[model samples]
Target: MPRVSFAPPSLCLTFLPLLERLLPSLPPTVRDVDVPPLFREQFILSGYRPVDLSWRCYVLSLFQIHNETLSVWSHLLAAVYVLVRFLMFAVQQGGGILGVGLQGPEGQGFSVDVSSLPLVLYVFSAVTYLSCSAAVHLLHSEQTHHSLFFLEHVGVAVYQYGCALALCLYSSDTGWTQSMLGQIFLPVVAVVVWLSCIICCYADLHFHRPYLWHRRICQVVPMGVAYLLVISPVTHRLASHNWTNTSTLPLHFLQVALFLLSAVFFSCPVPECFSPGRYDIIGHSRQLFHILLSICTLVQQEALFEDFLWRRQALVREFGEERLLLACASFLGLTLCCVMTALVMKRRTHVQLLQEGR
Candidate 1:
């Protein structure tokens, strides 16, 4: 056999670079330490991680290797799905994607009602929440994350109000907001409830170290209470509502249960905590929370749509969809104002750390 001589190292180096260019490439993966402190959870070992690289690199990182890849995609895709569905619904009625002023009972031969506009805003709020979640986890900017958390909780609170209004619309013989006063206490109580949630969520970020455990507990308490309070009233009257049968409660309960489960996963990072880095990539508590929350949103959406379709006759007979839309517009405005107000700015510790090049 003829002896084979290896190429010179320098010559080999030249060919290696060219060969690398010719071959299929993969985005680089990262270690946890290179990621944000928020992601430095216990046991998070070998998943894809985000680094504070350049802006272009950060955008490219979406498809690149990272632990939060699934989280970013799931929520982003969910927002897309909601937007698409809303657009489809709006297209048929000749309304814009926002679907403003386009309302009727759900079903074929869609009729128009001006009063039903507020439901459109509520849908917008839900979409806002999902979209913000995707943005926050994907970008992971300290300022944006903190601000987005405020936005996220506010979105959640607004969606809950929408949920209450939908349920109230179903339960009563009047339009959505008109009947909101006596039966649906959520609209009245929600201002306090959501504002409290926003504050706690803000504190969770703004106040770091010292009583870290205490801060976490404080976050959980508000969320836990909000979940309990919001779900109970919205779901309790589902079956007995004028538009729904006794049998519907089971399905409605499923929606509420999913929301509750999502809350549990959100508040208690159980299995992930137990296993640590084992579930850093997928099946993490946060990912689970995202999935459950999306499912709950869909479940409630379908039910409310159906409830509106059947219940529209009653509402149209009384106040009309236009009136309902107009009245709830104020409520939507209040929610937006409160959320914007709660989005308080604070000095970002993580950004400061990164600035020192640590």
Candidate 2:
């Protein structure tokens, strides 16, 4: 034997084979995930880093005080205000409609036999407000991308549904077919078209591009044409019948056009592609568009009510009472359900995490 020396293998050499195996088995990094090229371009334009600490938690921590804090609180306060208003309106309307000694719209004491239309409408308004508030507050603490994305999409639908419900209630309260063109019957056809567009757009998003081309060709494009055509005849009838004064026609047309334009803008985001971060926090095209739309809807509410009152007075009286009670109960129930589900999910997650720690 030369020197009879024995030496252990080096640690690095001993683990080299295992390390090579792991290199081959590991998945790609997060940056390597397949995202759209447009999105990639947006990221580059944003000048945002993948590893930078997000302001999300800081923003959420300000549930106590900050700009967004007040914004959140403002929406919540608005929702509460709406809820209170609904309660008051329901009490007043329900009492009258149920044949109790309740004051009617004219302050005359009469036996109210109308179904719950007034109450239902109020509840609908309250629910809409609540949904908005919930959406706003939730924007901060989303933690995960999916939650925010889904919630935003859902917010649009909720807002749309609220608007539609409010309009339908106005129609029911006054009269659907009693207006100038409403009476002529094409309004129904127009409404059907408009509603079909809404359904198609919502379905496309919710179902992930169902009947994509068909929706564009059949529902969306047709809806646009139908909307324009229906509006002309209806406006003409309204003006001639004195439902709306002739002098108001120009103003009304402008208002209607504004809403239609807003909808189009919202459906298609423009000018954001050039400068993405410029609109990241505020002044986004869609936000401005929605604000304008909400205003337009509020303005049109009166005209809609006038038209409906003339046409659907009997239907209003019929469902005015029962619908209210049912809706109030439904609102309370829904609120409770949302709260409970959120709480239960939170608790379960916490419990699971704690057990894992143990």
Candidate 3:
């Protein structure tokens, strides 16, 4: 026989068998996988080890099939859906932020300056969708346990930030005057308290940081309760019988509650999380969150639209032009936030990965 070329024991004896056993299929279960020699050699030469990269890649691999594929596409499609709706609204009612409204006869639909309000509202809603979409895609791809745990919350933060901005704009536009009760609670204080509650909830989930024995009092329950306490009073005032044309409390309260509920749904992760791998590719917590979020966004748009109509018909009808323009601005901001956040995160992750690769 021809002389056999000597192979290194590490390569011949160690890695060959492992390679034969692993990596044949795209979505092979890898919780207990052995490192192949080629990859191991790369690691040794680079003086680094796999830092959950494989798992991250593996989890993201679900995009090809498994459970999370539908989840990913669901939000991706939802983003597209929102974009279409926003565009339709813009086309039907032309004018930029601060535009004139439709003032024509009943049949004509000729308008005054009710333009900007729609656009601005659209923008805020778009931001919410984009942030949510990015979070889903990124987390799905995140294989390492730590990556999943850390990046997951970022999505919620994005969602909350968008809502906060929207609420702030509403507060200013409608001149949500502070009452004595509100003075005692304060907007700034409310925000701080909500943020604190959110942070505490996240800590409980990831860090297993302990809390009071009353389980119901922990996590989302506390958040919901705190929300009611801080926001309810103002919402109640807005909805109170004494109010007439301008108060935006009832609609605002409804929108805010729905938004909060969406977040809670995301955090609690019912149905799928309970089933685990059964919903890995579809019907997962993230997917449900996306659906609820979309509905919430649509509801919010309607609420904002109603507010705009009220403002034009009754409150400060003088600036129909300005209101329209403001709406457009808001729309642009919301739509852009989604695309912008995705690009930013992509760039950041790419840079970090490249640096790590080096």
Candidate 4:
């Protein structure tokens, strides 16, 4: 006779095969807590920090898990939408020019290039904000927290200035460009002031860990001033009992309100802040901010579309091509300046992070 002993399968060995299968599906090197101090204030509980990830992994993150997934996807998709809009406007402008040229007295060449400046800037600004935001959220860990944050703000300034210019171009007659004293100058001043505000914040650069709301208000206030200056014509017309462009007025005001609410969400950062770990992967305020911002931009894009149809000829007749081109060049220069400052800040901060052993 022999004594026989039977043992159950080892739990570790039994699960090993399944674990191996799931391992490839999971993101490698996902950090759960213990995020470095530099990234703390920027992310505010981004669940798993992916450290030292390659650019390939950053792109793969389009499908991977992380706190920034929503923020990244929303803006990237917006970038696609904007590019499509840019093309759509170009095609329509071509059609309009062709139709007008054939019907007009001369039936010769047209100045579609100058007429399309607003839309071009509209596209440029949209792409800037969307791509920069997507880049920031997707690669914040790569650039260190503060550097990306600074870049994101600068991107918004450029985008805001673009939106302001677009609305002014389509909102008013081209004559506005000639009257630098009363009208066009306001927006340029506002852009300068907005840049100054951004620079001041980065001067000593507190980054405002606890007082996130203060930073939010500080950044948006100057932007709001720029917006207000650009839209003053609308305000003036409506106040003076002129109902010419009333159709877009209500929608524009609605957009202004939505943006104001976006600021509120940015400042408060609710739900996520309420339960730190609970909303780590989703439902964060930044996600909401990005969504609201996209919607606001979309609404404004539509408004510009209608305004363009109405104001196209007025724009062509009122402002010369040289003036429009110079203005576009100036806008591009200002946008470049903001971007340059952000680049410099990023490099300096990278050095700081290295010294701090992050």
Instruction: Output the TM-score of candidate 1.
Output: 0.74
Model number with the top TM-score: 4
- For model 1, residues 316-356, the per-residue Cα lDDT tens digits are 56656565765577566758665655544324435644786
How much is the lDDT of residue 227 in candidate 1?
60
Better of 1 and 3 by TM-score: 1
Candidate ordering by TM-score (highest first): 4, 1, 3, 2
C-alpha lDDT score of every prediction, in listed order: 0.63, 0.43, 0.47, 0.67
Error of 2 at 167 (Å): 4.9
Query: lDDT per residue, candidate 4, 1-358, as tens digits?
Result: 9988676569978998887655433354444456545445443555665576555566667787677788888889888897787567757767553222344478765534566676677777888878988988887764555766776777777776676667666765434444563455634654664575365347425554444555555666666676676665555444554456457766666677788787777766677666766666777787888888788877777777777778777775666777767667777777777777777777777676678796
Task: Give the alpha carbon lDDT tens digit for every residue of 289-330 in model 2.
Answer: 555554454445434434443444455454455664543344
Worst 10 residues of 2 by lDDT: 24-33
| Tens-digit lDDT track of model 3 for 1-358 | 8999676776577877776556433534321124333222111122112233454454455455533445556566666766666666656655433343445456456544443443354454465546455454544332332233334333433344344433433333333435454343334433544453345334534332222334334445545554454344436545554445544555665667666767765566566445544544456555666666666666655555555454445433433456535534543453344344444544554566578793
Clash-forming residue pairs, model 4: none
TM-score pick, better of 2 and 3: 3
Judged by whole-model lDDT over C-alpha atoms, candidate 2 comes out at 0.43
The clash number for model 2 is 18
> If both were scored by lDDT, which would come out higher, candidate 1 or candidate 4?
4
Query: TM-score for all predictions?
Result: 0.74, 0.44, 0.50, 0.76
Task: Give me the runs in candidate 4 sitting further than 4 Å from their true place.
Answer: 1-32, 41-46, 93-112, 142-146, 173-187, 190-197, 200-218, 234-246, 350-358
